[model samples]
Target: MEGTPDEFGAYRLLAGSVVPRPIAWVSTRSPDGVDNLAPYSFFNVVAYDPPVVMFAPVGVGDDLKDSPRNAIETEEFVVNVVTRDLAEAMNETSATLPHGESEFDHAGLDRAESVAVDPPRVAAAKVAFECELYETLEVGTSTMVLGEVVYAHVADETTTDGKLDVEKLDAVGRLSGSLYATTRERFALERPD
Candidate 1:
């Protein structure tokens, strides 16, 4: 089906109806020693062999966002999982802060040093992936930063027989503007043999 030819309208419609998007609660350390924390909806696991994850920072108004900048400059970052318990604090970090200012301090989040990367992880996060910057791709005004997972931390409560229990994780997701969702009910689908 053919739709309207305006980029703004089309993009808005696409973003609005994408069901639920997993949020990447990203933390990065600025060059001047400030820690930054923020959430990005445009995130996903890209590869498993090298264990790569990627997130995109959409250019607001005109310039690249802080997460992308810090990841590129520092070559490291931590992607924290947004669980129901930390949803409020996660939302607080989404506020637009002035460059060089840290959302971690703004949101009053705790920090823990990563084992494999310099960027710290959110102390209260249910799961955290410590990553080393693998690549950065500039797409129009936005920037996609890809990283290789060097270490991971999962809350003890969320682990069951060497696997993460989604119910215990209680992960939150992004849904359009000012809308959020949680992983309360889930189902498993298997491919036909």
Candidate 2:
């Protein structure tokens, strides 16, 4: 089914069927040192050899989002994993805040220092990635920002036997519209030998 769609129609279709997209709760620091936080569903890890992660910030007509703008300016940002417990606070930071306003303070989310980046990580998140912006690609009306992972922090309690315990992390996912989902119940399948 080959079809051409206007921006709105294409976006709606893509957002609707990208089931259970992982939410990247990004924290970025402005050049003036103010912190901003927001969640983006158009995010995923693209490669492992160089540890590349991609996130798309869709422009509102022609304006770029604050997070991507900050990343472009500073070349660093932190991606925090959203858990069920922090879903409400994560959603709060999604509100449109004035430039220079700290989303950490506005949303009441705690901030923690990163090991390899200037931007701070969300303190309550079970997992956090401190990344350095590798490149910014202008695709149509969206900006796809690629990041090189510089450091990763995983809560000790959430790690078990050298693996991240998904159940213990209680990660939250984004759904269409204003809906969210929790990874409370999951089934595993092993690949055939």
Candidate 3:
């Protein structure tokens, strides 16, 4: 725990320690028009007002992962929220497919046209954010892609009083290797002014 661990070791440590991270079920399209869908646990909202988010997709060996690759090339992506209902389909898309293969097809999920970006949204997803690429930072072996959310679609049931209701949203979270968590259990706290 003192010195730097290998990439795999560090990844294991980080994933285990992060504790219930929000998943970004990202969708992008290859230059040849092949649709791609993959889930990233290394994802979170970076800022509000302007509405920014980031996801770090690590390279497989030396090659950039398809999510970051397509986002970088196309300058567009869609972040779809994962729910218990869509867990299996989201996991299915994580398989390593050939560059031109479409995960949306592999996962048997329907694609809806995004309002702002070229990449399609998962029609089964309760929430989807269409984003334009803001920047990408080359980490050690991973690329951190930041996107500016330009549009969002939320299912009518997922909202309450014009705000997102976490209990109703029922979004899934990443807990380590094969583990996932739900948003059913939560608590609220008042901030000190």
Q: Would you estimate the TM-scores of all the predictions?
A: 0.92, 0.92, 0.93
Q: After superposition, how far is residue 54 of candidate 3 from its true place, in Å?
A: 0.6
Model 2 weakest 10-residue run by lDDT: 1-10
Ranking by lDDT: 3, 2, 1
Candidate 2, which segments miss by more than 4 Å at Cα? Answer: 1-8, 60-62
Model 1 scores worst on lDDT over the 10 consecutive residues at 1-10
Q: What local lDDT score does residue 9 receive in model 2, on the 0 to 100 scale?
A: 86
Over 1-193, each residue of candidate 2 has an lDDT whose tens digit, in order, gives 5566664588777787787888989999989888999999999998898998888988733498889999989999999999988999999998998888888999988899999999999999999999999998988889998899989999988988978887788988888899888889889999999
Per model, state how many residue pairs clash: 0, 0, 0
Q: What is the C-alpha RMSD of each candidate to the true structure, in Å?
A: 2.1, 2.2, 2.1
Model 2 Cα displacement at 174 (Å)?
1.0
Q: Please report the TM-score between candidate 3 and the true structure.
A: 0.93
Q: Candidate 3 at 110: error in angstroms?
A: 0.4
* Candidate 1 lDDT tens digits, 160-189: 898987768888988888888998988889
